[model samples]
Target: MFLTNVLNESDCQPIKKSYDQWYTFMDKNVEFWLPDSELHTKNHCARVLLLALLIGHQKGLSHEEKDTLGMAAAFHDSRRLNDGVDKGHGIRAAEYYKDFCREHELPYDVQTYYITSYHDQDDSFGLSEITNSPVVRERGVLLYKIFKDADALDRFRLGPNALNVNMLRTEEAHRLVDFAKDLLQKSNETNS
Candidate 1:
C-alpha cells in the first residue's frame, strides 16, 4: 500500500541498509557452488541482494516484488562452476532453486527462476526469455533489469571501471552508483 502510493505520488527516497545487517542474514539456505571462493560467495550475494532491494525500493516495488528480488539474490549464483565466465551457471542455479523448492515443499517463484537462469547471459537473450514467460510477463522485464543492475553494481570488485553508469537499467540504480562503491569498499571484497 505504501509502495503503491509512493509510486503514484512522486519519486521514492533512496535508502541505505546497513551492510552488516544484510551480510549477517546470509543463512546459507542454499549452499553456494564456490563457497570458499573469494569471487562468488555469500558476501557477494549479500551485496547484490542489498542493492536489489534498495533499487526495488527506489523504484517503488511492492513488498512482494522486493521479496522476489530477495529470492533471486539468494539463489542466483548458487550453482556456479567457477569464478570465470560460467556460461550456463545461471541455468544451473535456476535448476537448483527449483529443486530446492521441490525438496523443501516451498512455493516456487518462476520470475526468480528466470532471473537466476539469465543473470549471467547477455541482456538481449535474457530480456527475450523473460518476455516468453507469462508468469512474469507483467513485470519480468523490469525485475530482470533491476536484478542485472544490482549484480552489475557489485562489479566494482572486478575493477574500478567494471561498472558503466550509462549501462545501468534504472535511474534508481544509477543513483546508487557511489553507494555501491562505498559498500564494496567497506566489504573489502575483490574479484580475482
Candidate 2:
C-alpha cells in the first residue's frame, strides 16, 4: 500500500523521530494499556497511527499534512497511561507535544494543538457536532477523521465471534466491516 510505503520511507524525519519516541515510551509502559484478551497485544495507538498514515495517503494529503497527522497519531493515546478516564487526554497529549517540540527544537503552531485535541476526542462524540465547530472542522480536522476511520477499521478486524456487534454501529465502523471481512477471507486462504 502507498501508505505503508510512505510510512517506511526515511525522509520524513519529524514523523520518524516522534514515532520512535512514542514506540519506546509505549514499550516501557505497555501495562498501562487497556487489556484485550485477544492474541494480539491490542496496541490501539499503534494501529491508529498506521491507520492515520494509510488514510492520509489514500486521501492524497500534502506532505506536511501527512507528517502532522502522523505525529498526532503517535501521541494521541499517550494519556491512556493514566487509565484514560480523564476527558482531557487531548490537552494532555498537547502538553506532551509541547515538551517534544522544545526538546526537538521544532516549530510550534495551532495545527499541533488542533491535531492533538481533536485526535483525543471521545469516539462516541458525534461527528456532526464536531464538524459544526469551526476549529473542529478545519483542514487539520481531517487528520482526526482519518485517524478515527482507521482506528474503526482495525477494531472491525475482530469478527462477529470475537466482538460485540454493537461495536460496529457507527457509519465508519460499518464501512470498515466489509473491508475487514475481505481481509479475513484473504488471511484464511493464506493460512489454509
Candidate 3:
C-alpha cells in the first residue's frame, strides 16, 4: 500500500492518508462472509478500496462520493460462498449491507447498493438488466464503473494475465495498472 513512490505526489498523499483510515475501519467495522479466505476478504477489499480511492482522486469525485466507494469496498465481496464465479454473491452482499446499515443505524447509500449488487456481473448484463435505471445510470454510473474497475484491478491476485486493461472502464483505472500489481505483491508480502 506504499504509494508515495509509485503514485504522483498529488495522488499519493490524499489516498495514502485515506488508505490507513479506511483499512482500519474495514478491519474493525465491516464484516466479510469469508474472513479466512485468501481471495475475498479484507486483504482483497482493502486493495480494491485503495484502487477505488486512487481513481476517485484522479477523477475529482468529492469526498462524499468517495465515501460511497469506501462503503462499496467494505461490503462488495463480503458474501462470497466460493471463489469460482459465485453468481449471486453480489446480491447476497447487497442484502447483507442493507441489513448491516439498518441494524447499525448508519445511512445506506443506493449507489453503494447498486455497485455491490452488480459488481460480480458483466457490465452489459449489470447495466442493461439491473444498474441501468435512468436514476442509477445518471447518478451512479461513474461510481459503479469506478468501483468495478477498482475490483477488477485486484485480479492480479488471481494471476498476472487475469486483468485485461482494455476491460477497465476508466482512464484512471488504466493509470493504476502498475500500482495495482505492486500493491498486490507488497500487500501479500506484508500479510505473509
Candidate 4:
C-alpha cells in the first residue's frame, strides 16, 4: 500500500520505469520458470524490489546503484527450487542471472552479480559479517546490505519465521517492516 501510494502519487519516473520494467521482465522471462514454491514468486520479487528501491533511495544511492539493486532483487530468487532450507539458491540465482543477462545482452555490473550471488547467505544478515568480506566491501557493501534487507523484508511469507524488525540491517528497512508485513498478509489473503 505504501509503495503503491507513493508510486501512484510521486513523479519519480525512473523508479516507476524500473519498477515497470522489472514486472515485464519477470512476467516474460522469469515467472514461468518458477516452481510450485510459494515463497519465491512474482509477488515476493515485487515486494523485494520495492523494498530495495525504498531503502536504497533512503541511503541516497545513485540512480545506477538503485537500478542494480532492483535488478538483483528481481533475479535473487529466479533459481529457487523449493522453499525449504535451500542453502545455495543465491548461487544458483546468480548463475541464472548471468545466463539471462548474456542471452538478453543486458548490461550488468559485478556488484549486482555479487549481491545476487550472496543475498541468501546467512552471513549477509549482518553488516559486520558482510563487511568482513573484502570483495563485497570493495565492490558494494551498501548495495549488498540493501539487497539483503530488502530480501529479508519479505520473509513474512515464511509465516512464523517472518522477519523481525531487529534483524533488518538498514534503519530504513527496519522502519518498513510493518508495512511490508501488512502487504504480505494482504497478498496472502488475496491468494488464499
The top-ranked prediction according to TM-score is 3
Kindly give the stretch of ten consecutive residues in candidate 4 with the minimal lDDT sum: 1-10
Give one digit per residue, the lDDT tens place, for model 3 in 48-152.
888999899899988888988988898888889988899999989999889988999989887788889999898988777544465564648889889999999
Better of 1 and 3 by lDDT: 3
Writing each residue's lDDT as its tens digit, candidate 2 over 83-152 gives 4345676677777777777777877655656666665455546344456666543675566566556555
lDDT of 1 at 166: 85
**True lDDT of residue 43, candidate 4:** 77
Instruction: List lDDT for all candidates, in order.
Output: 0.79, 0.54, 0.83, 0.74
Candidate 4 residue lDDT tens string, 82-131: 77777778878888888888988988566777788787777535345446
Poorest 10 consecutive residues of model 1 by lDDT? 1-10
Which candidate's lDDT is highest? Answer: 3
Give the TM-scores of the predictions, in the order they appear: 0.85, 0.56, 0.90, 0.82
**Ten-residue region with minimum lDDT total, candidate 2:** 32-41
In candidate 3, residue 188 scores what lDDT? 69
Which residue pairs show collisions in model 1? none
Measured with C-alpha atoms, the lDDT of residue 89 in candidate 2 is 68
Model 2, C-alpha of 139: deviation from truth (Å): 1.3
- Regions of candidate 1 where Cα sits further than 4 Å from its true position: 1-26, 189-192
